[model samples]
Target chain A: MILTDLRGRYQFGFGRFMERDYDDIPGTYPLDSRTYRKGYHVNMFLMSLNDAECRDKFAEDEQAYLDTFRMTEDQKSAVLDRRFLDLLKLGANVYYAFKLISFDRQPPQVMYGQMAEPRLTFDEFQQMMIDGGRPIDGNRSVEEWKDG
Target chain B: MAKLIAGMGTSHVPGLGAAMDNGKTQEPYWKQLFEGLEPLRAWHRANTPDVNIIVYNDHATEFSLDSYSTFTVGVGENFEPADEGWGPRQVPSMSGYPDLAWHIVESAMAEEFDLAVHASMDLDHGFTVPLSIAYGQPKEWPAAVVPVCVNVIQHPLPTALRCYKLGQAIGRAVASFPEQINVGIWGTGGLSHQLGGERVGVVNPEFDQKFLDNLSRDPLANTRISHTEFMREAGCEGVEMIMWNVMRGALEDDVDEVFRLYHIPVSATAYGAIILENK
Candidate 1:
């Protein structure tokens, strides 16, 4: 009987981040990818200090740690503006992003680019990725198309 | 006297078969992918007249991680399609040859294999993928399949030599059957690719090629490769290649290599297919 091994051809990942223009400010703290997308220019600020010790000190007085970060009225308003703290409290999407990054090790990016679009369903995205820039046969049902 | 016709070794990578069902083969990039199987298809039509007793792993679909058996055989009339997140594939469910299947089960037991016999089960992609490739989705497939599902997913899985000996038992059982039938044994899964955890995309093409070559010439020698070494050289999942030794042990020392196909696609796994006929 015929046997064919088909592995390592398609990659799957999350959509690209939306790019936007941000005004450059001197001495501004670098932002992590997660916080940067949320319009927070906050830096770790405590990079110069021992992170564990600072965290322990902060644990003693939480409000003092919050007041330590110097912020302008506009920055404070923006931070509170979108319920950003509440969202941060909801926890980071490390699992989701990790799954996306896993795609990096798969096949080339072009094979799965169409799947990166937000509009497609997971199955449709999988099908589109597998199609790999080819037209799907109109006649075959989803089940028919899948049978070996 | 009924004799062993051929022995085949293959990778029953779930994603490879899943890709076919997912319409991956129709893509231009994958056009060359399915073409590799043409020779095997031709060989099957010309020479493989009856059923192939497929040796494969269940990937924890039929047998959960809670408890795992080393080896299981299907002696049931029909097998259900497993729900592997995407539900079952659209095809006629396989009907077992209970008489033939039970005979082998009994024979293997008598021979000290301690095989678990299943009266009812839904075979996962591991069993079905090779079946689909060997025998297309015919209204009724020519061969009456007797599935021998191995447990490779769980730790303390069957040893390479153990699977090889099981194959020898299978050969004896097939030969003892009252009805004369042209039977072939198939061993599926692995030629090096890891599909889990941080080391997911690992591939060892060199080891895979060597394993296939050694399998054809000196299967016993190939079976000597340890599970630890197999995992180290072929990746953790590569340990599944042990199943091939089972098919190899069933055949003569030197078999004619009919066809061999190897491909590595987007799934971060290595795919291999080989058919060897008795010289």
Candidate 2:
């Protein structure tokens, strides 16, 4: 079934983490109508990273630069801290969010590797791709939980 | 009569364009990617196509959530390379063919595919990186272009089957055009890798290679793939494979694989490319 089909309503009861743990789901984001609205200012600042002059201004004084946009403190701090993973949580699409990574003059592989829970070393992550890929089984969630 | 001569697919990862710009091809990280492009560069030089039908998507640079079109046809006269948050590649402005673009638009509408028309569009790295990869940073882009834009970033992206059908309609449109032009359809983006969420840096060479193998004869099998399956088996961004179907379906079902390259860790993705000449 399409993901949209899983929308509408759901009933809940009982255990501690009752809601689905979406953390284990790989390569998905809320880059749709809702997230777009939330992250517009953050994304706008990111888009400005295309300009060399803008990047210079941004790196010079991070707070004053980000103040130009209407982003939340979290979004502004993410830009300052280079918290790419946190930025995603606050609704940054990777395509637009990558401008931040570019601003730092770092390859995206570094950020994604750092974001991996259980946090992989850059070498360990690169090795994963070469060894086919991260195994689909068990890796979906920590310990014994499957998506089902 | 206008004819579709060949079709090719390339990853338009911005890192490749940067590598070419900074002369980092000789460096260890980019050496293999530059080496892979050598044959493709020669192929374009030896024989040039009059125009290229570039199938690519914008990365929130030109079209934001303000107005998103699922399928856009550029019927403009010229396209400027956009500064996609990290400066534009120093490539020449791309030439566009309005006559051919409009004809395809009309034909696609006639075939029940309502393609949005773009009078002005800025070509992002998704559109220009492939140009830099194959043509080098020439004074002017040798081949004229017809840009076919798709919406891939947002969820509920257009499916592979729809893209393939659009390519077939485009093929019929090209054949009916009243000009003696040799055209190439280029699909750009994503061999396999996830850029967002927990699965970032996940690259699958197996899925990438098999796709290269099966694209010539068994394309519909690739098109029949579900979105979640691609997310699971290939990764989220790997769903960009639908763009290749648009290129493949434009050619005849039988295509000869001319040149192929598959390399890993180009920035963060598995970059795969292949040149297929229609038989």
Candidate 3:
């Protein structure tokens, strides 16, 4: 079930509260320019890792791998975080990680709170994942899969 | 008196021209759709507008996601086509009418619409697709173009009402110009299809048709469409359709639909075109 296969199959909806809540506290935890740059670097790094050749290049010299981009201290920390690396190994894309870092700017509870809704809630999304024969269980939540 | 000769609205789908350029449009399914523009071709030749004020969106190509502006006006004499990974389209570079563009900018400012003006700017699919479709690959485009690239990709984009207001300002600006010239306002992008993460290639034909219908009669009805709802139904990129309201607002309520066409499933986008003539 690749994301592409879900096209035109289902209607997806997100809780409006997520954006409303985020807007209410503007700049309370805004990412400084430094953190934003690092986030972009992380994005580029993830893009690079998409290919086996690039992954092998990264494995050979991880430090040099990071040096190629201009990243800030906090961005570097977030990218180098062991937890994030685990997510990367599981096939999360750079855009996803950048979103996670953006969420990180808020409190951890707020970050996780928004995930109450599945990333792909539409039936079309589920059908695509199923057709692709990709495991959706890993991304599913106890609340989301409880009916099944 | 200078007149609003034509009102054009089109989907600025990045892949449309690329599809045609690469001979994808020759495929049976696409050929019929591409040929539908023949009527517009005939119409354009007959009217032969001297200038077009094109309103479109920038897909994080000229402007980054890091910082976004609600509205930007190109006052530069020339604009370079953006390199959107697939490389620039094989088309002649576009020259801008700075005098006209700057006049619009100044007029917009006078109307209290704070617009960002750029001396040197690169245009993405938003501007290029409509131009390519309307004028074709001419030795040079038939008329001078003033590119108005709206920031619809980033979060917190301008509201539909604001965009409509900007159109009024643009209309006023174009009318105030001392030089008499036949001008067209071309609005591009979206008849519903989204291209983005997770929800790529979504199309809502029903909504799209209804939108085009309402747009012709009551453009203000379009303002009721929320950003999230647009992203949800039309797909993330489909939100770019807001630019069409600019064209609609600038035109008289009772406009004749001179031309209309729609094509679906074109590399993850729905392609559409509409030409409205003022009564």
Candidate whose DockQ is highest: 2
Tens-digit lDDT track of model 3 for B1-279 = 456877899887655777666767777646776788888878887887777889987653556534557788888888888654335677778888898899888989988999998888778777888887876667788887898888775556788878888888888887888888889999888877533232333467767887888787778899888875665556546678899988887787688887888766454456778999989
- The CA lDDT at B69 in model 2 is 89
lDDT of 2: 0.81
> Model 2: what is its DockQ?
0.39
Decreasing TM-score order of the candidates: 2, 3, 1
Q: Which docking category, incorrect, acceptable, medium or high, applies to candidate 2?
A: acceptable
Candidate 3 residue lDDT tens string, A52-133: 4555665677667767766544545545563443333233332234334322332222222222133432343424322331
lDDT of 3 at A12: 34
RMSD (Cα, Å) of model 1: 18.9
Q: DockQ of every model listed? A: 0.02, 0.39, 0.05
Candidate 1 per-residue lDDT over residues B9-78, each given as its tens digit = 7776555566567777767656776778777877887876466788888753556423457888998988
lDDT of each: 0.61, 0.81, 0.64
- Model 3 CA lDDT for position B166: 89
Off by over 4 Å in 2: A1-24, A51-61, A120-148
Worst 10 residues of 2 chain B by lDDT: B226-235
Winning candidate number (TM-score):
2
